[model samples]
Target: MNNPAPASPSPASEYGARARAWDWRRALAPTGNVGDAVFRAALFGCALLLLLIVVAMFVEIGSNARLSISRFGLPFLAGREWNPVRGEFGALPFVYGTVVSSLLALALAVPVSLGIAVFLVEQAPRALARLLAFLVELLAAIPSVVYGLWGIFVLAPFLREHVEPPLQKALGWLPFFQGTVTGIGLLTGGVILAIMVTPIVTAVVRDVLAAVPVSQREAALALGATKWETTRVVLANGAPGIAGAIILGLGRAVGETMAVTMVIGNRPEISASLFQPSYTIASVIANEFTEATGDLYLSALVELGLVLFLVTFVVNGAARLLVWSVTRGTSGVARA
Candidate 1:
């Protein structure tokens, strides 16, 4: 009844079981390490490429602007005259227009964008939030030329007929609102720029608000806070991020060309009146770069481009720093 001595496990079977039990980690670790190294190197290369491109752009702009830099010197920035026929150039008006228009855009865009962000992050149902957010972003995808054309045909007339009249009537005493209802000026340019950049500001603010932890909102609510109060608390915490968003949008406004050129009336002068025609750095470049006749004129335009590049660089750099600081703070809070 020793039911035929229990068959001993086969050596082959034992070896097969051992093979089945073997760890893939031991087999694939070297390959994974190689892959990781390759991936890291690829990322570094891409970063290097981006940096090189920026450096190349700076070099190209500097080379082209060299004559103007030598002739005009540092005063080119503060000088107000831009007589192309006499070979004299100054950047102040372009600089002023760029600054004023971008600032106006930011002023007009920030409140509305922030409100939209708040609604999307705090009050909206998921489906509605996504839909609205998508639409908002789609607004940004429209070409600047399209916005410019729309501004010329639609917005400019609308302002002339409806909006600017009231502004002129009510605020005419103010230096900014005193001019005729021409509908194509710094004010109109600002409005177009605002519309163009609002989506960017909104999207950034929405993302910043979303990053606010659920617990922060819950704590705000737990403290007998109203919904608006909770939102305010969250917004206060994210203020630096919002500033960065606005500044980033300002940078976008500063760089806009076609829309501003088409609707800004292309007059290169510093005027307090919002209704007066003005020229921005980008607008000048877009409008006159091809027609630039003399070496100095071309160089001046290139120098204007250089100035614009610097301004955008500074604004965007500051924005990045602000956003970085906010992100670091938020991450620290999350870890804590």
Candidate 2:
């Protein structure tokens, strides 16, 4: 029994095999044209340039700070005294102030930002949302100097006269509320930072919440969830993005200089009370850079800048990762 002649490949199979082979060939091939090669090279160059700039900044600052780093070593981080006269320096107080003020700003801003974002994304009418969003964005564009001026002239007095008095009267037993209510201190600086940070957090959170699939809201409502419950579901789904937004805002508050410098009283001392004056790394650098008379003093200031740079870089990197994760997750859900 002679075997029948093998059947010819079907058209669909032939086409599929050709497509697969083409794909493999394309994958294995070198650059197909000069344009493609040039584009790839340009993109790589841009990325390399950015990396080089960051490395250069780090090296320059480190070299400038070498004297202080050599003299103080690890103790410089925890040293409490920052006496330029005696060539003594410590970063602890500045670090403490930065942490406390930034935390206070986050505390005051996060709730307000969340509320505004939720309302704009879910509850407000289109026209109203547009108007409110524009106003919120406008706040971010206002110069830091302008905010500093407002903090000095308006917010500080208001707090000293009204808010701080009530806070002290109600919570005076707490060390945080026991100091004299100075118009310029950590509290004032925090409030100014809160005002600056709220706009950014709100904008980012509003976008993140809006990006949640509409199907999610519909499903929750289909299950007999109330409006607030539906909103809560959306918020839960977008939690990562919200966290990223908050971290981004914290980074902003951390690097803030002019506004904080103007109102933070510029005192390099650690204190338990928010009403007491304090200094942040940025504030101290701005106040003393030009006035640094000794080499050690200048080197110490450069070291402080390096610290700020590292902190900001790390915070921003974490924020970017969180934001990217949420964005990718949301896209996957939408596609599904």
Candidate 3:
């Protein structure tokens, strides 16, 4: 057969040729258009608002830099001294407390939150899941002050009576528990922080776990995987997002004022013992901001606030990046 006559254009192709022949300049406007202007304005407005907020914080805190440097020096971050009466002000103790409590909260909350999320999204009946989720959300809605009161009246005493004594007995060989279980130490504060942040971590984790497509679970089941194996794979795939949830919860823990302040005992000293009471940056501010007598004191507090804000910002930003990486990895998996 003659080299199949160069495949003739179909009728649809002919119609397309005719269509391109017609002028449609009015119908399809040029690139510079109304939509572009509106989009630009909206973006600019958002950027301007964000700039204003950042500028406000900078301006507010900049006024205190001179005092912070003059009084404390660069060594403030490393030195453990924090005597306001003696005019010595090192942030080391507060930094230690803040980090310890936040990390401790993360340690305690992450597993429990993950379990709750996995159970709710994967295992529980629909009505029970909804009820439990509502309860967690309700916990978040509870005011910090309420949590503080509960910590003071209910939780603290229980820890003092039951948890602390046993923990001290068991881990007492460790330096962190070498001292008496005074019921208002780093461990106690951390436990309170864990309780306060549990709802947050659980809620975020629940959402992320739910976002895992059913296909993954079905595929695992098809491969004869056990329920635990399927769940494990889902958790492994969503590890970054779960980590982000923990970090976000930690951000909340670091900034938590009322509950930590109420139970932390606000002692501005560094000790190896977790049972030795300590003060956090947020607790220090909450406890003393009202009565802060001098300019140095007030500025120091403001500077602490700035430090906390920076810390939480970094943590949350890192968490988002981790989640983004997970999403990208998940996309890669889908493509492959």
Q: Score each candidate by Cα lDDT.
A: 0.86, 0.88, 0.80
Tens-digit lDDT track for model 3 on 206-310? 767766878999999999999999999999878887888788888889989998898888998888887788899999888888998888878788778878888
User: Compared with the true structure, what per-residue lDDT tens digits does model 2 show for residues 1-336?
Assistant: 267646543556555665564543223323334565567667778999999999999999999999999999988989999899987899999999999999999999999999999999999999999999889989999999999998899999998998999999999999998878888899999999999999999988887888888999999999999999999999999899889889999999999999999899989899999999999999999999999998999999999999999999999888867766666545422110
Clashes of 1: 0
Error of 1 at 31 (Å): 8.2
* C-alpha RMSD in Å of predicted model 1 compared with the true structure: 10.6
TM-score, every prediction? 0.85, 0.87, 0.82
> Which 10-residue window in model 2 sums to the lowest lDDT?
24-33
lDDT, model 1, position 325: 59
Question: What value does the lDDT take at residue 224 in candidate 2?
Answer: 100
RMSD of each: 10.6, 8.1, 8.7
The pairs that clash in candidate 3 are: none
Best by TM-score: 2
Better of 1 and 3 by TM-score: 1
68-185: candidate 1 lDDT, tens digit per residue = 9999899999999888987779889998999899999999999999989899989999999999988998999999999999999999999999999898889889999986788999
Instruction: Between candidates 2 and 3, name the one with more favorable TM-score.
Output: 2
